[model samples]
Every structure is written in C-alpha cells, then in structure tokens.
Target: MVSPVAVPGGAVLGSAFAWGHGVNLRRLKYFVKIVDIGSLTQAAEVLFIAQPALSQQLATLEGEVRQQLLVRTKRGVTPTEAGKVLYRHAQIILRQCEQARVDMEAAGEGLSGQVSVGLAPGTAASALSLPLLRTVRARHPGILLYLNENYGTTLSELIMNGRMDLAVLYGDKAIHGLSFLPLLKEPLFLVGPRAMPAPAQPVKLADLRDIELFLPRPYNVVRKLVDAAFVRAGMVPRVVAEIESAFTLTAAIADGLGATILPASMAREVVAACGAWQFQIVDPVIEAPLALCQSDHLPLSEPAQAVKSILLELVVDLAGTFAATPEPELAALS
Candidate 1:
C-alpha cells in the first residue's frame, strides 16, 4: 500500500485501498462528482464506473470521515451539513492537486499554465481585458489567460470555490473566504446622450431625480452605492430599466433612452465610444471601490502569481494616468 502523503493545508492523501481509516483522492473525486450531479447513478455513468462501485466508495468515504455526507430522496441527492463542508474543502483540494501537477511539470522551466482571471462588468477593470490579454501574451507565451467579465458577486463565488484564480471587482466589504487588495476609489459620473445639453458643472444627486436612468439590478455593487446615495438624499431615482450588459446600456443611452451612472474610467470609455457626454456627480459625490480579490485560504500557483503581478502593474499605470487627468480635462474630452 502507498504511504500517506501530506498536502498543503495539512490534508493527507493515502491509497484508496486504505478503506475505513483514510480517505483518498479518488474517493473524494467521486464524492464531489456525485454531489455535483446530485445523483449516484448519473455520476457513475459520467465517471464510467458501476453504480454499486460508486456507492461503495462513498460509504467508505463516510466511514473514513465519520459523517453522513449525503441525503437521498425521490428528487435527487443533496449534501448534508457535514457534506456541504466537505464539498467546499474537496473543491479546494482538487484544484490544489491539479495545480500541484502543473507546477511539478513546469518546474525548472519558465512559468507556464492556465490562469483564470475575472473582471467584473461596470468597473474600470473590465476595460483591462484586452490589455491584460496582450500583456500576458507578450510576456509569457506559455501562459494561457482566461478572462471572465461578470458581476462581482458571481466572480467572488467562483473565487471562493477555487474555480477562479483572481478577480478585479468593486467592493471592499469583508467576505469570509476571500481577501481584498484595494486598488482605487473611482468617482461616479453621470453619462448621457450628446443630444441632451451637457452640464457645465458637476451634477448633484438631487438633480438626477427627474432624469430617466438605466441601471443594473439592485444587487449590483454599483447599483447598491447609487441606491444608498439616493436614499441618503431622500430621493428616488427614476429607473427606466435594469440593464446588466454594458453594451446594452450604452446602446440604450445612444438611442436617447436614458442616462447611466458609472465609474470615471468606464464612463469615459462609454462616452468616447458612443458619442455621449459625462459629468462628475456631486453634492455628496459617490465613489465606487475597486479591489483585487483572491481566495484567503488557498495559495496561488506560479503562473497565477505572475499574472497577478502584471495585473497590479497595469492597474498602477492606469490609475496614475487617470489621477493625473483633472475634471476640466475630462470635460474637454467629453
């Protein structure tokens, strides 16, 4: 029998044949797959193993952990409380195992592996997608970069599950399993069509009360900030529609449908591309917070670390340029 091997996070991996004493990687994989599919028979079909064999493996796993991990029902199987906890750890463990293999294979050679980075929509980081892709390609040809543009909450969930390596998203709120590195505080701007007369000065929160607006759903980080500001001012915004896609929002704005509030960088880009205009918000200026987020418990692989370094460098460069530009300069561009 193979000896028990200690992995990161103080977890032990031993032979699957160790039976009632130790849980092995293969069994953990089976358990995770079964939970993910929510059916043992289906999992067996997908795993190309007999149903009885998969059931036996799960029994052995439960015995090793001394916990009931699943509940069977007519609908499907669901993880028990203990199973839920184990499922989270199992995801991290599997991801670490894969990373270990990649690290070992690339040892002594230059860094090379796939790194998945998420950039939340409606934030300045979303604009970095192309730049990041180009930079990674130029710097590390061996690295495969996967960029996901999504909502902050979705990206954070992926990071917590160990499915994504890192993300640049709005919000500095403390999440349980994630760590945030605050990048910059971006002032919000009121962006609208050029057909509408541009404001000579910064617009106030109360001033936007009558203006029809196109905003993301209430759950969005930017939307929450805007809503809180409105509530503080004792005013209700006139929201014509809830739009999540930047393209769709911009299209609506270009069609003279409504205005939108966005961070400075994203606002600038939107106005420049759609022939729109933007002015900063005032009378209690609202700012959206941006941060780099990663798993608090898991370690980054070499490729991920390298990509993160490059991301930081790019953020610094972008922020410096943005900071140097004054409101007057922004107005001129608008």
Candidate 2:
C-alpha cells in the first residue's frame, strides 16, 4: 500500500491512485465538518453518524496525513496551525466541488443560483447593496443575491475563505489567496453638527487637532486612514467617542456631540440627513481606497460571474455619484 505524501506545510497532497496514499474527499468533508462545528459529538450528530465512528474517521485521517489536525479539549476542539492550513484548503476544495455540480446542472439553463456579495460598512460601497440587489433581480430573475454589509477586513476574510463570492471594500494591499481590483479613491471630509462653525475652505489636518471627533475604532479602514493622516501631520485627533454604527454616528453629530471623519460620499449623506456641515480634508488630501476582492484560485460560478459583471458596471456608473475618482490604471488580479 502506498503512503500519503506530505507537503512542506504538512498537507497531504497525493493519494494511492495517483502517486501515494491520499486522504479521500469524504474524509476531508468529515474533517472539515468536525472543524467547523468544533465538536466531534456535534459533528457526528449533524452528519448523522455515531460519535465513535466519527472519532475513528478522524483518527484514520490523522494517521494518513501524519499530522494532528485538531487540538481536542474538554470543551471543544480547535484547529492547530497545520489544521488551519488544511481547513482553508478544504473549504476551497469543497466549494469548487459544489460549484462543479451546480455548473453541470445549470449548463443549459439560464444563470440561476445564489451569489453572495459583501460591501464594507462606513464606505461609499455600502450604498450599492440595494442597487446590486435590484439589478441582479431584474436581469436574472432566477438568481438570488445575498448582500452583507460589514467591516472591510471581515468582508475580505469571507472572500478569502470561499464563503463569499466577491466584495467591494476599502484596501488594496495584496493578500495571499486573494485578488484585488482597485476601483477608485474617495477623498475624506470632516462632518460636524450645524451648530458648529463651518469652514469656508478645505480644512487641513492641523485644524482638526483641537476639534472633538467621533470616529470608528482604530481597526476600521477609514479610521486607520484618518489616524495615519493626523499622525503624519504631527498631531493626534481629539476623539470624544468611538462609534461603529452610522445611525449612532449621525445621531451624535445631530446632537452636537462631536465631529467625525468619513469618505466623501458617506460624509455627504451624514451632512444631509443630520443637517450637518462638511468640509474636505486637504493640505495633503486623505483619500480612502476601495477595491473589489475575490478568491484568487477559485473560479466564480456562472451566477456569481454574472453578478460580478453587473457590480463592475454599477461601480463605473456610480463613481461620480460617490464623489470617487476613478483610478486611471486598473490593476487586474493585484
């Protein structure tokens, strides 16, 4: 009997049918389920198998791969580093297999499947969620569009994990196992209560040093950009509150709690709704970058591809609407 071949990262590559004994896809599914549920007992119940049988399968998988996948504990199990690597690859593999089945079934039929798209919250992209839903519904009546509005980092991670098809988010940094298309850049603006004095000209970073500000947490993409801009100008912002919800932020601005920094489009909305004042941030204009993120290796399903095309077209049409400057040079798969 041939033995499974282990790669540098302790991932089993080939099986007996090929060059060496390999972990079968069924076992991979079991392992993935176990990891996802974080409890073999729960996984067995979900998979409709006996607990002992599930344990035996996991043991066999570990033996074949020659790497311990889960760290079993009293409460639950967690994937080790090697287990995490396997889990990530397993998600992609399972998604690809499912996509293959779906593709075959819908070969002659029109595009008809669920496609998940994420839009980063607190950015101009969030405004596209409803438009995308409407467009997909109008063009492909059979297709269902699932939209998620969340943090850029969270959205990007979902795309990387194969859980989400695509995302419009802030950031252009190249991430492993992910591809990015730089969409456009929107300038930052300072939004404050109407009760406060409004600046006639674009406000410099230094001008904001003394003003009380309400901003998202430091991990937020827009917050990071705002923080970096202030840091470069040799000052720190006077943050009165760290707010995550747009409603709460707008309410605070309306109540004259403090000012906040936001992308041009979002700032405009807040200003309009809250009867606030907005001035562009300049003297080294701070612009927030937005990009389209997707899995670098996974081929998009037919429905997903159709939705992506529509999303791209929508972005182009709404670029000016969002006060976003289109990138002259588009980077493909960056």
lDDT of each: 0.83, 0.83
Per-candidate TM equals 0.86, 0.89
Report the number of backbone clashes for model 1. Answer: 0
Model 1, 1-334: lDDT tens per residue?
4444334456554334354456778998999999999999899999999999999999988876677889999988999977877787788778888888988998888888889999987777876898899999999888989999888899999999888999999888998889998777788899999877776575878788889898889988889999999999999989999998878988888988889998888788789789999888877888887889999977999999999988877776666554423223222322
Instruction: For candidate 1, list the clashing residue pairs, or say none.
Output: none
Name every residue pair that clashes in candidate 2: 15-20, 15-21, 15-22, 16-20, 16-21
Tens digit of per-residue lDDT, candidate 2, span 100-213: 787788778878877899988778788898889889989998787888988888888888778899999989889877898888899998899988887657687887888999
